[model samples]
Target: MPAPVSTASALPARALLACSRAYCAAAPRSSDICSSLEEQWAKIVLVIKYLGSKRTLVPLLTKLVEASGASTGLDLFTGTTRVAQAMKTLGMHVTSLDSASYSKVFGDTWIALDGETANHSELVDAISHLNSLTPAAGYFTQSFCIDSRYFQPFNGERVDVVREKIASDYSGTWLEAPLLASLILAADRVDSTTGVQMAYLKNWSHRSKHKLELNDPVLLAGQGLAVQGDAL
Candidate 1:
């Protein structure tokens, strides 16, 4: 029998390069990837705090979506719609989907809100009014968790009042959505635990600074974009 060919001689010399080229050709062009939402999300200042958010995974998730050639993104269990909003900012077709009624409320506001005119002055004034309310005596008055180093407390009644005020006063196609999302974010920021409880952090030491600004959708509307419904 003829001598067996060496293993190295079995394949073409340029096999690796050829395979790479074929892979590249079959994949979607990087230029086709949407990136606007990612850029917009990068600019968001976390006003409220949250636990277990996927914000840190944003870059990885964005890259994965881009690589997977997903033309449309549906965010199921869309907590705060952070990832979905980012995808939307990227200009990818994005739908923020959720089952919870509260989530439904958020999705409607974030995904489908609109502003016809720029009202920076008006918005700033509204934010100012919303911030003036003090913590409720009934809830904040009672401490939830106390440690030697720190204590975590919440003004439940005051928070309720704020929610009520927003429900009654704030009106927009999308203003309330981002605004509520932002507030929820802020709540996450201030809470002491990795979970949603009025418990103090074991090592709590951060400046109590409050900053508020108009969220992305409102800004987009201000820029003359027409926003519509928060449907799937």
Candidate 2:
């Protein structure tokens, strides 16, 4: 008889799909993933500071979805779209619904978001270009850096320039949503807020000092609809 295969996760509970190098699902709430969100099968990582993110529950959730034997599933309250992303990996037609605009980007990037598709390598190059642009002080810098303490002045300027470039070039196109999503993920790494974004810290957190960078968002191939609105 053939030897039994181990069903355990290859990476430890803390080792999750990282960005080209990217965020650790197991890392502290204060740090950012250095690379981009990239995953291979069971190795999925999404680092968002939400009190209700189900990222850690994905392993168990995947098992449940597998047992259901259903081809389609509905994630009515997709908070961070983590479960929905996992369900899609199971080859199920998944629908992720949330009321937040950023959720739409997550839905498009991980789920079946509407948008123009590009070659993966080309997308990488585009991300590189975004990173190369010179950062400038814009409304984002003044508001988030000076007015508020979400990010330091250095990283805030980086955020501003890159976002302005993306807005100018890809705004209103399918590319726009995912690109914005990518920026959000990158910025999340260096922000000073205490995860929920309700407010900033009295002092800059340890991770808030890192430079802002954009990385490739792990793109999943599956069928699903990203809905933005009231779940009701």
lDDT of each: 0.48, 0.72
Per-candidate TM-scores read 0.51, 0.75
Each model's Cα RMSD:
18.7, 11.5
lDDT of 1 at 217: 33
Largest lDDT belongs to which candidate? 2
Question: What is candidate 2's lDDT per residue for 103-196, written digit by digit as tens?
Answer: 8888877788522354677667778899999989999999999998889999999999998998898787666766788898788777776434
* Best prediction by TM-score: 2
TM-score of 1: 0.51
Q: In candidate 2, which residue ranges exceed 4 Å CA deviation?
A: 1-49, 113-118, 195-197
By how many angstroms RMSD does model 2 differ from the true structure? 11.5
For candidate 1, the lDDT comes to 0.48
